[model samples]
Target: MRRWAMQAGLCLALCAGAASAAPAPTWRGLDPDNTLVIDTSQGRIVVEMRPEFAPQSVARVKLLAREGVYDGLLFHRVIDRFVDQTGNPNNRDGGTSSHPNLPPEFDFLLKPDAADAIASRASDGITGFVGATPFSASQLPRPDGTLRAAGAYCAGVVGMGREEDPGTGNSEIFFMREPSRRLDRSYSVWGRVVQGLDVVRTVAIGEPPAHPDRMIKVRVMADLPATERPKLEVMNPRSAAFAALIRKVRAAKGADFSICDIDVPSRSQP
Candidate 1:
């Protein structure tokens, strides 16, 4: 049985009632432009894209969304504790897109004080949000004692899965279901699941789910019909409010704090 089904069964056994209502919305630092609304069979999953860190990947996702390439695709590959991947028109192995393949954007320089906010003792690196997307950074000091950093991978991150060639990532994207620090330098980190994480956790698990879930519809928030569009607010990682949240979380977790522990806050409205 799928993890989601098992969990749902557990909920039914324990609660003996309908699922509880969702929490009230808490609007924070809103990024209206970069959000993507994905309606899947399970539920709606909202992703906030980061062009600053992975401009090409963001551009590719936007283009695919606008062109309607992602609609009706299966969550072809989903492993319980690792990731759930899709966006292959050929199902799992044979899909291709008219869009050109992109070179890897594995690492980039940190913008401003992002370095100070998510100082990661777990990986000897740093982690923080650029817009609503959470990222970790690996660094080594130069001869002049200046540190150069690259993005790190954590849970909720959406990354490109590639073939043998590092530059072949065109349309295959996956959601990180758990923290796989080993992928930090390998895959290109592009966006994050800001809302509907519970839905993500329920995706059918298998290399190919026996009954795979599909993305019913995918839209860039900008492209949605005006009345149908969702208003989303995500805490700006670079803001004082987010800084305070980070401090509070660090204090609470202490030695147990990992970048994956933080889920950048976001709220959505129809």
Candidate 2:
């Protein structure tokens, strides 16, 4: 069972600009405490947390993860074209940890990154990244220029799964293998997949999958011993290579480009 039902659909077709060879990218380190290393039955998937969007939700996940509450939890309800749900201790909708429920975090106060990495523009809103998570905000800022909006539910995005009561956001969470734009502004998105999206896509599918896939072990990257920690680096959003990639993509897409089309690149740090 899942805390909330999640759905996926056929992928939307978008133009992918070809990336040309460039100088080695300048790497940015992911905050270990904010990165989740989910080693599933099939493989490992790395999720980068966005505390800026849902600090409480992020805290809840970190607490349970650090406590080993998610180990061996089944991907209880996986939809073929939709989300992969898990993290329910009782494996049911009402299942939760001893911790209290949290209020809904449907949207966050949006602020611009120091880099000029704008991805999309609408009459009133613009989309940009907060550590690889794409979010949109209003052009008409508040009197003080602090706008607010939700992040997009792009494929491979990680979100908090809640039941009927908005405050029931606790243990259960889901990974989006397919984009669910309708979920934007309705669910609390806390992270994005930085690696192993393939592992997420390979989770066995079923309402309650017979012989379902499960997480072998879930750990906050910071909790892992130095010898066990993953060495990875993400492309600096402000890097010239990244900026060039974005320019190529925006130009190739012409008027059809969107934030969803920009896949943030990462690599293992040698």
Candidate 3:
């Protein structure tokens, strides 16, 4: 029965973007150990990660970033009002990484509100789907007879990390092409395009001959000196208030678990 409960918990975490499977461990929070700042010819874009949420994926990116693996990498694929994908060491064919395929880190119930916030949306109220699963909530959950604000899942063009493909994430990543209301609960969003969006908009679209955009280098802004780095302060979810909320929620739910068990929301890139 304990084993079964563990399995059940694992399943729930997978749904929440926490664990990929029973065998793999989950990420803790931002990989301050290996943060990155993407430098494009057009401009620089900063990314703050949450390794606690997806540790394996974050470690994989750090490994690649430190080796300068993504340096001179091309944004091999781009779609207007959509995503730009890269990470193929060769920028040709489906990119392969040194790591093995990872399991899905789903942590659904852990952060329903945040998940809803990032979910993709259509012009109509209807929600979208990915891999045959609906991403966002069409209606709000009211468990105690009280009205709750309608919540959504992650949407829009999100930074893509490998799911079910462990080490497969290496240096490759993708941006959402548009608001993906349906994908809110399905994918793990590592970071966002905080700057140089215009350059991303101007990326050469289409496959091959027309694929002109490329990532010259990717660095972590925090790692740089104050004068050289951009003015940015990533909200540390470890703050006292944030930690208190997690305790309150867990206590209210009558659950005994690590604070890491709660899904902390990601603040939008400024």
Per TM-score, the best of the predicted structures is 2
Superposition error at 21 for model 2 (Å): 24
Error of 2 at 222 (Å): 1.0
lDDT of 1: 0.72
- Lowest lDDT sum, 10 consecutive residues, model 1, at 11-20
Query: Each model's number of backbone clashes?
Result: 2, 1, 61
Better of 1 and 2 by lDDT: 2
Query: Which candidate has the highest lDDT of all?
Result: 2
lDDT of 2: 0.80
lDDT (0 to 1) per candidate: 0.72, 0.80, 0.47
Q: What would the TM-scores of all predictions be?
A: 0.80, 0.87, 0.55
Q: What CA RMSD would you report for each candidate?
A: 13.3, 9.5, 12.3
Flag the better candidate by lDDT, 2 or 3: 2
Tens-digit per-residue lDDT, 159-221, candidate 1? 887887889989989888877879886888887888887788899998788999999898888
lDDT of 2 by residue, 1-270 (tens): 121111011001001121225543467888998999999998999999999889999999999998889999999999987899999998756688888888999898764332125566576677777777878776554543356768889888999999987778889999998888899988899999999888999999998999899999999999889898878888876567777777889999998887777888889987
Q: Residue 107 of model 2: what lDDT?
A: 91
